[model samples]
Target: MTPARVTGTPGRTRVLIVGGGITGLAAAHRLRERLGPDAEIIVAEQAMRLGGKIHTVDFAGRPVETGAESLLAARPEAIGLAEAVGLGDAIVYPSDAKPALSLGGELLDFPAGHMMGIPGDPADVAAIANAKERPDNGLPILEPGADMSVGALVRSRLGDEVLDRLVAPMLGGVYAGDVDRLSVRAVMPQLAAALERHARLTDAVNEIKRPPSDGPRKPVFATVDGGLERLVTATSASARAEIRLGMTVRELRQTPYGWEVIAGPVPDPIKIKADAVILAVPASPAAVLLRAVEPQAAAALSGVAYASVALAAFAFDRVDLPERSGFLTPASEGKTVKAATFASKKWPHLGRRRQIVRVSMGRLGEEALLQYDDPTLAKTALRELGEHLGMRLPDPVEQRVDRWGGALPQYTPGHDARIAAAREALGVHRNIAIAGAAVDGVGIAACIASGQRAADTIAATVVAADR
Candidate 1:
C-alpha cells in the first residue's frame, strides 16, 4: 500500500476526497479547476483499482466495458466531463439496431411510444401486454409531492402485464431492482411530475414524449471509443491529486479548524486534515463514517438497501445472430439471465471484429447466485443466453465474469424524501459534503453532477474563509 502524501496538517487549503470511484475523481478534478493549481487535493480509495463499477477490458481486438457499458448521453455532466478530459473524439453512439424483449420464450419488439414500458396508447402494447386503466374518479392521478411504488402506480394505471412484462424487464436491465419496491418519484421523475398535472397516464406519457424542438434527436446513449476506463484514467491525471490507493477512510472528525480524516489500515492509522472533505463512497461506508458527526443523516442512509448483480462477457469466433442489438428478459420468465447486450452488433467499432455478447445476471434477493465459481456462473450465463437466442452456440474464444456484490443501490418508495431529509440534516456543515450513487440517481452523469456540486460548495467555502 502506498503511503498517504498529505499528513494531518491543519489550514493547508487542502481538500480530502473519500473513495476513488468516478464520483470522487470527478469531484477532485472539478476542485482543482475551481481552487487553482496550488490547492492540495487527495483521493483515497479502499480498493487497489479505481473506476468503481465502470470497468473496461481488453477483449478480442478492442476494449469492452464489463460494468457500466454506456453513459446517458442526454445528460451534460458526463458528456461534458468526458469532453473536458479529452475523450470528445472517442465518444461513440450505439448502432440503430433496437433491443428486443423475450416474452413467453419468444423474442418480440419493444412496445412503441412508451416511457420505460408504460405506453402512450394502450393499442401500441396490445400485442404484448393488455393495458387496463382504472376508472376515472374525477381527480388527477396523484397529489402534489405524493409518492408510490412503481408497481402500484403501473398496475393501478395499466395492469400487471405491463408491470411484469414491459416495465420490469426494461427497468430491471438497468436498476436490478424489483418494480414493486422501486419508487415512482425517484425512478420516473418526469413522468411522476406529469402525473400530478394530468388525470391519465397516457397524457403524462405524451407530455414527457414532447420533442424539445423540430431538430433531429440526439443519441440517447454513448461510450468512449477505447473504453470507459479511459475516462477514469484521463480524468484522474487531469485532476493531478495525490492518489491514495488501497486505503480505507475509517472516520471523520470536525475540528475547530476544519476536518480530520482517519484513513489507511486499522492497526496503523493515518490522520489527514483538510479545509473540507467530500464523501464519494457507497451507502454502507458513507453511513458508517457519518454516524459520529451526523446521526440522523446516517440513520436515513443506513436503511437504504442495495442489489447485487453480475456480468459475463464472451467473445466468439463466428456465429449467426439476430438483426437486433440484444434482448431483455422479465423475472417472470424464471431465467437467471435478465438481459444480454450484443456488444458487437450494438457498437459499430466492434461489429467488424468478433461477436461479443455481455450477459447480465442476478437481481434483488439473488445474491447467492454470485457465490458460484467463475466457471459455473459463465456456464449458466451461456445456457440462459442460448435459451434466449434459441440456438446452440459454439465455444467462445474468450470468457470473463465480473461480480458486483451490492453494486446497485435500490431506491425504495419515498427514497427521494429520505435522501432530501438526510441532506438537509447535513446542510448545517460548512466544510463537509456528500456525493455518491445514493445521493442522487445512479448513472455516470448523475454521479458527476453530484460531485461537481459538492466541489462547487467546497470551493465556495474555502474562498469565503480565506476572504
Candidate 2:
C-alpha cells in the first residue's frame, strides 16, 4: 500500500480526509472546488481504490453496478452533483421493470397506488382488501388512526393473506430489517406525514394526486451514464488534492496550532498535519475513530446501527421471465431475500436476451442467511428465482457473491436525537468534522450531500481562522 504524500508545513491549515469512499472523495473534491488557494487539502483512504461501496462491472456486453445501482429519482443532490462534475449527460432513468411481490412461492403483481404498502386509495386497497378483516384490510385514508409496524400496516391495508402471500417478503427483501422493529417514521417520514395530515393514508395520496399550484418542491434522484463510479473518478481527477490510498489513519489528535493524524504502520506510522478532518468510513469504524476525540459523540455514533447485506449477480443465456423488474419481500413473512433486481430489464445498457439479475439478501438483525458460501448462496438464489419466475432456469454462466458485513444503516426510532448529539459532541472541537453514510442518509446522493456540507464547513472555518 502506497502511503499518502505528506507535504506542507507541520502547522499549516490542511484538510485531512479519512476514508476513500464516495463521501470522503466528494468532501475532498468539494473542498478543492470551494476553498481558496491559501487552503491545502488531502484525502487519506484505507483502501487502494477510491470509490467505496460503488463498484461497477462491465459484463455480458453491459455495465452492471455491484454496489449502488441507481440514485433515487426524487433526490436532487446526486443529479446536481452529477451536473457539477460534468456527468449530466450520463443520467439514466429509474428501472422500467415492473416490480412483483413473491408470496408462498407464488409471484403476485404489486398492488397499484400502494407506496410500499402504505395504502393511498381505497380502490387500490380493494385489490387485496379482505372484507372479514376490519380496518386492517381497509384503505389507508379510510383508517383514521393506525399506528402499526409496516407489517401491520400492510396486513391492515392489504390483508394477512396478502401480507403473508406478498407484502412481508417484498419489504423484508429491501431493508432486510424486521418490519416490527423497523420504524416507518424514520425510514419513510413522508408517508408518516401523509398519515398525520390526512388522518387517513389514502386521503394524503388523493391530495398528492391533485396537481399542486405552488409549494415547497419535492426531492428528485438521478444516476450518471457510465455509472456512479464515473462521478467518483471524475471528482478525484479534478480535486487537485493529493490522495493517499491503502493508508489507514490509526490515530487523530488536536494540536495547539491545528490537527495531527497518524496513519500507516504502527512501528513507524506516517504523521500528517491538517487544519480539519472528515471521518467518512462506516458507522462502526467511524465511531471507534471518534472515541478519543469525543467519547459521547462516539457513543452516539455507535448507536446508529448497521445491517449486514449480501449481493449476488447472475447472467443467463435466455431471458424469458415475465417483466418482474424489482420486487421486495417484507420481513414479517420471514423470507430469505429482501429484494431482487432484474438488471438487464432495468437498465438499457445491461441489454436484453442476456439477462443480468442482482439479488439482495439479509438486512439489519436478520443476517443468518449471509453465512452461506458462494456456491450455496448462488444455488439458494437460483432456487428462489425459479420459484418466483414460475419455471426452472438454465444455470447461470456467470455468478458472484458480494458480501457486505454492514452495508446499509438502519434508521431506528430516535435516530434524529442520536445524530444531533453526535454532531454537538464533535462541534466542541475546532478542526474535526464527521461526514459519511451514517450521518444524514445512507444513499449515494445523501453521502455526497454530507461530504459537500462538511467541505463547506471546513473551508469556512479555515478562512475565518486565517482572518
Lowest-sum lDDT 10-residue window in model 2:
136-145
Provide TM-scores for the models.
0.97, 0.86
lDDT of 2 by residue, 168-217 (tens): 45455545556655555555656655766654445655555535449853
Task: Give model 2's TM-score versus the native structure.
Answer: 0.86
Judging by TM-score against the true structure, name the best candidate: 1
- What TM-score does prediction 1 earn? 0.97
lDDT of 2: 0.72
For every model shown, the clashing-pair count is 0, 31
> Model 2: runs farther than 4 Å from truth?
1-7, 10-12, 129-174, 192-198, 204-221, 332-334
